[model samples]
Target: MTRLLGGIGAQVLAVLAAVGRVAIFAAVTLRHLVTPPFYGREFLGALLNIGWLSLPVVGLTAVFTGGALALQIYAGGSRFDAEAVVPQIVAIGMVRELGPVLVGLMIAARVTSSIAAEIATMKVTEQIDALVTLSTHPMKYLTVPRVLAGLVTVPLLVGVGDIIGIFGGYQVAVRSLGFNPATYLQNTVDFLEPLDVLSSLVKGAAFGVIATLMGCYSGMNSGRGAQGVGAATKSSVEAASVLILAANFLLTGVFFSA
Candidate 1:
């Protein structure tokens, strides 16, 4: 009993310590975001990597998800003969929840793993130490640019995802579900409030920050060698995915509660 209790207590403390470290890391990243000696080239590269390169995956995910969502809503609504509500439901669902959440998860899967692996490999190669030797802050050069790129590009990605997702639903609804194309488009546009759009973009920014920060933090703190890099990559994605979901729930409550 004593050993079990002690083990549980140690795990809890470790988790809390990790949370504290991440919070401090995030604070430091944000502080550097506003300071001098910004790395424009690195920021642009990160922007391209995190945003442009991610479009195909984001689009594919959004379109398929939107189509499936439409189909599900149609089937469910059919029980009550409320099938006509598909457009509004899809719009609200995508803009308010599905679009941002799915995009965040996809980013976590793709970008987070890449960031962690790259940084960890750099660490293994001693490039981070080389930066220190050259009088450069590793966090400023690597972490800040990636974090800023995430902040700037993720909202754009979310907007694109929301549009593509709505289009996907429109295609399914009009083509297969017998919804009038014009009416469906109108309904989608009419049903979406400015706040819904705002919330989706806001969620995008928050999730992006979480995803990139997790990757950077894990990479920076990763242990030695291949095993360490692999572990860091896995842990980064896992942590980002979990945090994104948790943050989504909290943001949803804050935005829609009342």
Candidate 2:
């Protein structure tokens, strides 16, 4: 019993340590964001990599998820003779929950891993050290651009995902579920409040920061060699995924709890 309690305490301390490190890294990144010596080329490159490149996966995930959600909701609702609520439910679910969460997770899986691997590799090869040798602030040059791109683009991706997801539900409802297209769309539009959309965008922004920050943190602190890079990549994805989900729950409560 003592050993078990010790282990649990150790784990808790480790988690708190990690959280502190990440918080400091984020604070430093924010400082760099407002300071001078900003790198436009790196920021543009990050924008392309993190934002535009991420769209296809985000779109595909959202569409399938929306379709599946509609099917499930319709099936479940039919049991209670509440099938007509499909549009409203789908709209709310996609906008308030699924769209942002799914997009955030997808970004975590794809972008987080990529950033971690790339930066970890650079660290292994001493490129980060070389940047310091050349008087470049590694955080400003490397981390800031990616983090900024994430903050700017993830909300846009979430917005796009929400729309595509809703359209996907529309397609399924109209063709497969026998929902009237016009009425379904009208119901969806009428049911969604501005707060719902706002919450989604806010969640996206938070998730964006989490995903990119985890990647940068894991990479910058990685150990040496190929194994280190691989481990960093894996840990970044895991951390970002868990944090995104946790943030989603908290943000949902904040937005909806009365």
Candidate 3:
């Protein structure tokens, strides 16, 4: 019993320490954001890379996912002969949950790994130090722009994905599931409240912050060699993915629960 208690206590302490570090990093970054010698050029590049480049992947993923979701819901609903609800269910699910979560995870996999590895490689090559020598603030030049871009761009990506996914579901339902095209669209429009879309976009913004923050943190504190760069890349992706899922749960609770 004592050993078990000690183990539990150690775990709790470790979690607290990790939270403290995140809090400190957030506070420092927020301070710099307000007092920045801003780098508009890098920020624009980050915006384009993160937002525009991410669009194709997000759209393709959404289309396929939404179509599949409509089929599954129809199948399950048919088990009770309630197949008429497919359009409504698909719209609600895609707008409220699937859109944000899928986009978030995709960005976590692609963007987080890329940012972490790129910055980690820079760190390993002493390029970060060289920036300092050139009177550049590494935090502002590197981390700030990426973070800001993620904050702004990811929500747009999520919104686009959400719309595409819904349309995908509509297409599948109408053509494959024998749903009346006009009726399906009417049901979808009638069922989806404005709040559902709003909740999705808000969740996207939260996920964006988590994904970019993980990448930037790992990169800024990376070690000095190949092994270190690899570790940073791995850790950043892992952290971002986990955080995306966890945030989804919390956001759902907030949006749907009394």
**What local distance difference test score does each model get?**
0.96, 0.95, 0.90
User: After superposition, which runs of candidate 3 have C-alpha atoms over 4 Å from their true positions?
Assistant: 1-8
Report per-prediction Cα RMSD to one decimal.
Answer: 0.7, 0.8, 1.5
**What is candidate 1's CA lDDT for residue 69?**
93
Error of 1 at 239 (Å): 0.5
| Tens digits of lDDT, candidate 2, 1-258 | 999999999999999998999999999999999999999999999889889999999999999988998999999999999999999998999999999999999999999999999999999999999999999999999999999999999999999999999989999999999999999989999999999999999999999999999999999999999999999999999999999999999998998999
lDDT of 1 by residue, 141-189 (tens): 9999999889889989999999999999999999999999999999898
Clashes of 3: 0
Q: For each candidate, what TM-score against the reference?
A: 0.99, 0.98, 0.95
Model 2 misplaced regions, further than 4 Å: none
* lDDT value, residue 95 of candidate 3: 88
Error of model 3, residue 170, in angstroms: 1.0
Candidate ranking (lDDT, best to worst): 1, 2, 3
Better of 1 and 3 by lDDT: 1
